[model samples]
Target: MHGVVLAVLLQATMAGGKHDYNAAFKSADESGKPLLILVGTNWCPGCVTMKRSVMPSLLRKGKLSEVAYAEVDADSQSGLAGKLMQGGSIPQLILYRKTSTGWRRKLLIGAQSEMTVTTLVDRAVEQQAALQAESAEQSVVTASHVEAAE
Candidate 1:
């Protein structure tokens, strides 16, 4: 009973951006959805542009409907921001995709245009689908080989 309540609370808190980052990651993992993280600071002009304009536009277009998205303020979530960032640029976008073997990570630094973000998400989703198909095909082939041996 308590466990179920806690899980419900966690899911409720992870609806979109400006929520608990850890909760968002857990939700994405449990749902098998790709997690999209935007790391930025409030004072940065580029970061402001992304947070205010670019992301909203993508959301409106439904490009992000399939993703679990989170926004991390670099100033407040410095520890998490540091771990996700590869460069010193603000507004770093990170995508975590669950594959057959493990989680795949992709990153884009600096403020990006809507087209760039769309391309990254679309490409990642497409690649994940291809991987799933390949994995399924391998399983079928392995089963056939085992049956033939038997």
Candidate 2:
């Protein structure tokens, strides 16, 4: 609970950034925003480079200003981090969108440019919106069918 609150505050502090798994997941689910999780180890040179260069560059460019971003240390947050590492990649970017079944994820491995992240995020948002619209349409059709049956 405290973590969630802190995470919310963290988001507010850093323009939609959260380092806590629960915080990121909950916010993403609740707000219908795609969650971008960065998984890597602290000692990893790639991770350090990404942290020092790629992320900050994107942030400066305002590419990630509205993003629900989360950074996870693989060694510390094994539970959330392990699942993303199934493909055997470090400095992985995992984008998650909440769906009817659960969260659907898309992965981008290694360090990436701001343009790459921007393009991927744009597509993810569009895809999620389309899925949701389809689901809503199905729900309405199902309701109409049930009404017709009565």
RMSD of every candidate to native, in Å, equals: 7.1, 6.6
Among residues 3 or more apart in sequence or in different chains, the pairs in candidate 1 whose N, CA or C atoms overlap within 3 Å are none
How accurate locally is residue 83 in candidate 2, as Cα lDDT from 0 to 100? 71
| Number of the top-ranking candidate, with lDDT as the measure | 1
lDDT of each: 0.85, 0.78
Error of 2 at 77 (Å): 2.2
Error of 1 at 106 (Å): 2.7
Q: Could you tell me which residue pairs clash in candidate 2?
A: none
Give candidate 1 regions above 4 Å deviation. Answer: 1-20
Model 2, 1-150: lDDT tens per residue?
999999986775564243666787777878787888888877888888777788778778877654577888787667767876656678898898777788888888887777788887888788778887999999999999999999
Total clashes for model 1: 0
TM-score of each: 0.77, 0.70
lDDT of 2 at 114: 73
